[model samples]
Target: MKIFNLFIFLFFVTTLSNAQEAKQDFYKRSFIAYEGCEDSKDLERCYEISFHEFLAKHINRKALKDSIFFEAKKDTITVSASILYDENGKVVKRHSRISNPASNRIEGLEYLLDSIPTVKPVLDKKNNGVALSTRKLFGFYLNKAKDTIVPIFGYTPSEVPYEIIEKVPVYKGCDESMSNEDLKNCMNDKVVQLISENFRTNLAIKHNLKPGIQRIYVMFKIDKKGRVKDIVARGPHPEIEKEAIRVIKKIPRLKKPGYQRGKPVIVPFSIPIVFAVSD
Candidate 1:
């Protein structure tokens, strides 16, 4: 009787999981098209290119000059904002939120998103207009020595290069007194150890992956608060990618966040998980 009851419980759990998955599939993200991206086969890529072009054309350089921090801080500043598209394709800047607190100090970005021109309405799989959300990140490195600014743009503001960070984030239990290079190596080693212990190496066998080397590329950010955020993974199989993300999210908050020019800043890290599958 106990065995029968256990079977029933597992059956119920499986049924519930499948139901939830179905619901998620029904509400999956829809394709979004910017003005120039309307007929592009790769809408996402096209939209990014078009959006960057728009920013380059519309961003007010004069307003940026007004920000005192830009001239004084001599550090890289990154700002991110959400862009919302209603069912009818209208930009609702008022409803969008600026994510970073430092964004408030940049005069140029205050109204930068408000100038977003209308884009083609997004439609769901059923051809019904649906609301969509997108994000943009603007960054500029202030070269105090050169007395100039270098502009950078990407999908996320926290996607800063690892080599560019002056101080890499410190993993728990790692000595903070180590040199910057040593600290970086220590943190990476710890993270890799965590992944190896937690990631299910048997996934390749279960998924029937080809008998060869397989790699999963993962990217995430250690935010200014020293907590892991924005985990993304890509692999041959969805299950493998999901497992990679799970292991990454299990990392504990660090002893200290990364620093640049004496100020805490977001640090982006990417790692590849490679394994060999047997025949």
Candidate 2:
């Protein structure tokens, strides 16, 4: 009996060790692949895959789901959290911003976040492990008939390279209640509309400008306070460049500032405006 029991214990220990090593290998390969990605879109995609893999390996999803289903009484609740990681990928801090008025639900989410295991740090383009902030949204919907809760999760990088913010700065008049993806679309449409309505195409005609598509590139930053500034424009004609800058400067204060680790941060954006003129 003693020999059999010893054999069982040895098997269990070996199995656990192998599992840990496999997980570490997975993380290392994911980060290496992400670092090697060349295109911006490919890099973004790799970052997302690596992030979700990290969450899958480190988070106690089943426990978290149970806690939300059993503890939250609200029919629908949205919980947003900013998770800060150190150079070693250890969670340094976590802050939850719950839109629901229920204190119990908020507390439940806080507890779950606190219980998360240390994650493996992701490598940036520099090949260095740097501190980073990531955001997660947890949505819970209660089904009365089924006596269950349906949970949804969304993840985004809160801090990224200045040129690749996951959520761009939203314009003042855009719908604030929309999801992050929808808000981006709305902002793009609104900016194009503003430029089309205000731009002096008649100037091109008056100047006897060549009939073609004139492209203008503009880069600007929305400051931490939701104000637009640092407008720069380049175009084929000086007048076109001036008009682009003027229209961009006319943008009002944004509805909400960009965020990194629960704090507002300056967000930079670049867009190209193309004008078509026919003689």
Candidate 3:
């Protein structure tokens, strides 16, 4: 009789666990992810989410998901995650992943694959955590691994090299109910941090040092959504400019791109990033 009762209790627990409903809050995240990621199957879209996506799709992200990336009070291509509210519709987790290359941080380099999908967090634990249902895991990995659209690579006519001073998400600040730190920590703000870091790192690498500071012109289309497109480098010597363009392409994606109206469109932007070694 005792064994029979235990079986019944176990059965009830299983039923209850499975009965939990999948919340709609997860739906809201797709907008944020899509906006912040800016429709890239192969690029850095936002800061924290970019980092997470980098991990979910990145062959090696599995190793460091638990530990936050911190060195010298800064982040180097890592995500800091803490599980918070776990109700059906909420996941109040605190996360930070900063990878500034200018400060000599070895992050965002040696990345061969351009786009990687982050595990789409599902309110259903079955699709998110350990032992995620096979269906969810397979679906998530398949979506990230496969490219939705063929990449359209664009370029400019100028013959000079340049660099992006900074890139960030454009959006209203987080809700007032959020703590000051959390508000600032919103995923959009991290965009600037990522841009600055990538900019500095490329400079440190002497990307354009050989014939530094030549008249170079770069033209790239920023889609209506503000994501970068049609990157081209043109200046005095086309060869070196191409090299610069190559590096520029290495930078991550912009989460919130500039917009003209309701639809996503491409806008043009230019910059001359000078490379000089200080004495």
- The residue-by-residue lDDT of candidate 3 on 171-225, one tens digit each, is 2443534432343245324433333344333332343344333445665654545
- Regarding lDDT, does 1 or 2 come out ahead? 1
* Best model number under TM-score: 1
Q: List the residue pairs that clash in candidate 2.
A: none
Each model's number of backbone clashes? 0, 0, 27
Error of 1 at 145 (Å): 26
Minimal lDDT window, size 10, model 1: 4-13
Give lDDT tens digits, candidate 1, residues 1-279: 011000000000000011112343453334567887777877766776676666545645564455544444537765454567777778776656443334335345556667777777656557677766664455656565554555555433444445545466788989998866567667777876787677777776677787666778887888889999999989889998998889889999999998755677787776777766655
Q: How many backbone clashes does candidate 3 have?
A: 27
How high is each candidate's TM-score? 0.46, 0.44, 0.26
Screening candidate 1 with a backbone cut-off below 3 angstroms (N, C-alpha, C), the clashing residue pairs are none
